[model samples]
Target chain A: MWEYLNHKNGNVLAVKNLRGKNKEEFNYSQLNKKITKASKGFFNLGLRRGEVVALISENSPRWLIADQAIMRIGAINAVRGCNSPAIEIEYIIQHSKSVGLIIESRSVWEKLSIKNQIVENLKFLIVLEDESFGDFLGWNTFLEIGNKNTSEQYEELIDKCSADDVATILYTSGTTGKPKGVPLSHANLLHQITNLACIADPKPGTSVLSVLPIWHSYERSAEYFFFSCGCSQFYTIPKFLKDDIKQIRPTVMATVPRLWEAIYDGFFGALKKMPKFKRNLIRLLIRNSSTYKKNLRKIRNIDLYETSFISKLISLFLVIKSLPLHYLASLLLWPNILKQLCGKNLKFPINGGGALPEHVDLFFESLGVNVLVGYGLTETSPVLTCRRTWCNVRGSSGQPLPFTEVKIIDENNSILKYREIGRIFVRGPQVFEGYLDNTQASLEVLSIEGWFDTGDLGFLIPNGSLVITGRAKDTIVLSSGENIEPNPLEIEILSSNFISQVQLLGQDQKNLSALIVPNMELIENKFAEKNLLEMNQDFEIKKYFKSANKLFIKK
Target chain B: MKLKNTLSQQINYLLKNRSGSRLEEQIIDLIFVEPFSLENNLLTQTLKQKRKEIEKKYDCEIKEMYKKQIKGEIII
Candidate 1:
């Protein structure tokens, strides 16, 4: 990363701030300088190799600077978004044994409210913003400390960082009602950086808009890969996504499925309000193009669940029949739809974090934008498989990477053949060492034979494209791409006196719902003993229906 | 009805305390069903709730809840 940064000496934009009204841009040289000074600043604060610093931040220029600076000084970082649950953040800090904390702001710190309790041996704290942070270092003050000193053997520190050294620790919502820290080494990340270039292959100095939380392994790996290729990255929030897409005219972008869903839903809502004729025309064009694309995918042998020769012949006939209208849609209507959806230059937008909803997938691609879908967990540096241009299957997370091996196994731990649904396991250089300080948890997923169970149920097509079916584990993924580990929520709810047993549901749904068994004894006591009402099972069940509806309406 | 409101009150309190979170983990609605036991496949032999089985069994009820929501039939 340092070498690539040094090589790109020209005045090209490396990183830019796209938040509302905050215009900040840094070229490669300037970014290099900020990171170098920050590294010196970390050094001045007595941070050294193998020391862990916890970064609780969102997407910002300083975050990129701090991330590179921490790595440059031969230290490891444990990163989580500022919006994470306070207990989850505290667990990461406590478990990682982080010495220094680089927080997002004073409010994030205050929200944690657990200053020295979790981090008992804490040394220092740095706030990312420029506020009157009393008794703690502010961003500018920390940089000033760096500016005052640079005589240390920083080059030696860089040389000491080997491929096997742990780079970052990311916490994932484990099935065990706690977040598990996945420690990724430099080699694990580099495998992503080096091999992911084949996915998009963004040109140097081209624009790549980022909207995901920068600390997330998916976003972080994309940032590293794009920045290494010298692509300018602009960070934007979800609220400003549409405006930023038009303004930045990004050629490449990487984001979560939720953002894509938002864009699709936004277009859906807007189309409903459009004039009747215009809406009809747009729908017709989209239908024609989507049909052509779908048949073309089958003809190209990229369509999953359909492999018969008759299907291919039918697809071929349909593709030829629909080609002219499809071409017209692509030429006239699609260009405008693509421009409105992701901008004219969005050639290679990748979506990850969870399965892209089929509607959202076909919706975007119907507009002439090829949205690539990738698959992996944080333990594999977040990307084990990705759909490419040639192998762009509608419902599959393309083949494994160059050195990555993916297979499916049944309940008995036997490998399954193609198209057989089972748990997915991966073996690759990008796979992490293990869970931090939790060998038992690590042993549960990882095998001595070098395969790591992904805990996800999937099957490989004959062409080796991976289709994720469902989860073998307990994590519920909402349609918005948020992963909710139901165990903790169930445990918290079970403590309520009114509930006996609970199972949180909402896989691919908008919000979470639950199957609950009421505590009949407590409920009957509360109503009958209070003389408010006579307890009867049928009447109580009717009231339960009413209460459930009322609760939902309150949402 | 009282049992459901009591649980919602507690959950609402939890959500209130966690205001600035990106996505509030609120249980939009819940269904009152028979207790999950070993006999019902909704609970494992070891007594862990079989979430997938529960979801599959209550699929119609869950969808009805969401449909009720969309139709503005649920009153607060």
Candidate 2:
């Protein structure tokens, strides 16, 4: 990673942080110097090679500097989100045997200071901000200590680091049981940087918006890849995301499905608030553009929708007839609107961490925005398969990355054929070493031959793209012994405009049922328009269910 | 007026139009509440629903809904 930084021009910006009216830019040359100084400072603090260090912070340029510095000294970092529960943070510190900690704020220090006995192995604490509470060392103060060290010492430490050295231990955000630590080596991460560079081909000096939690492997690996390409990254908080997009005009971004959902809602919600005639005009244009793209895909032999031959023929004829109008709409209406919504400079946006609704995918694609949805777990260095720029399918997770092998298997451990939904497993150079200090747990998911069971239920299409159905553990078995995956059902139900979220529940029951959370704003507005002044909760729920059935039964 | 009763009644009404086998005739019982929120301990930090936590928290309401379904009072 540091090799790419060394060759960049001194004037070229590497990272920018927007603070109110002021923007802070750290160029590559300056960042390289700071990283070296920080590494030396850590060395002065008795942080030896092969010891573990913990990082608790939000996304910032300093966060990357601290992480790179730790890696420079051949130390492993155990990163946790700043918002993690106090208990989980303490548990990670003790479990990883982290010798030092680099925290964002004094509040985080307070949270960990209470459990000092459990974290007695922690010898040093470097607080990023200057706010002092206890025995914590300030960030600048710590760096000044390293200034005394000779440059030869820093070079020696970097030379001692090897590609096979364990670099970081990333803890999974446990949704089921206790969080497990996934230890990844430098080679494991470096492989992704090289592979992704070949696949994505991100140009040097491209601007990337850093939004997702940096602690998560999906975002972390992408950050390392972007930095390796010498791209300038801009960090923003959730509240300032919209404003920052306009100002930064980033060429690339990586985010989760929830953030995409919010953008979808915001776009359509704003459309609905427009005047009636204007609203209808934009909606018509959007529908035409969506159809144009779908028909174009079919014409190009990338058929995603299921339809009869006769219907497809008719659709093709219609598409040919409306080619003029489609071109007009695409050229005139969408480009500016998309730019206003998400910056005009966006080359492509990557979505991961969860399944993106197909409708949401279509909505963005219609506006000429390239939204690539990938799938992977933390154990696979986070990205095993991602949609390529040219071969993006609407509903399927894109083809596996080059050199990665993906296969599906049944409960009997036999490989399943294409289109058969089963447990997904992967083997690749990017796979992590194993869970830290948890051999029994690691053995449960990993086979002797090296395939890691992803614990996700999915199947490959005839074209080799994977479609995830749901999680294996989340499956509900009815009393009659029929197994059902709830994710697809829940996603289908959520497509209704009146529904906000849904969870299916029917374990050991006669039939599956769902807990629905209605979009109260839409319901209340509709009721008010109907002059139903005294509407009750029962009436609102019934109205929502009636609308939901129209979408659900069709599926 | 309870949220559970209102949701159960609504679900029962919605399933009345289904035309399927006897097994499919099983009416769905629901207990509506506010959205699952992270602050409420019903959702994880990643925004996934914490199933065990939610099931345990609403144990009483779930039992009442099951009893009402058994009595055939929830079906239209």
For candidate 2 chain A, which ten residues in a row score worst on lDDT?
Answer: A528-537
For model 2, how does the per-residue alpha-carbon lDDT over A1-555 read when each residue is reduced to its tens digit?
575567665556888877422255788888888898888888888887899999988777778889999999999999987776676687788888999988888787676545657546677888775554576788778888879856566678778999999989998754222468999999889888888864466777899988877888888999999888888888887688888888888888988776776677678778868999999998887787788778777765555544567777877886887677768877888778877777888886887777677778888888888788787778888898887778887777788987899999999989998789899999998987679999998999899888998888888876678888766677664533333555545554565555577677765455667677777766555555543323355567656556646645564
The digit string of per-residue lDDT tens for model 1 on A1-555 reads 655676664577898988923367899988888988999899878888999999998888889899999988779999988777777787788888898988878887887767768546777789886564765688888899888755547667877889898989888754342678899998999999999987989888999998888777888998999998899999899888889999999998887777887787677678878999999988887888788888888778788886699988988898898899888888887788777877899889888878887877887777777889999888999899999987899899988889999989998979999889999999999998789988998999899988999999989998778999999988888766678776766666665556788887777677777777987776665565443333334446346536644654564
DockQ of each model against the real complex?
A: 0.39, 0.12
How far off is residue A293 in model 2, in Å?
A: 1.3
RMSD of 2: 12.7
- Top lDDT prediction, candidate number: 1
Task: Give the poorly placed runs of model 2, Cα more than 4 Å off.
Answer: A19-23, A150-154, A175-177, A305-312, A475-555, B3-76
Q: Candidate 2's error at A194, in angstroms?
A: 0.8
Name the lDDT value of residue A211 in candidate 2.
Answer: 82
Residue A204, model 2, lDDT? 70
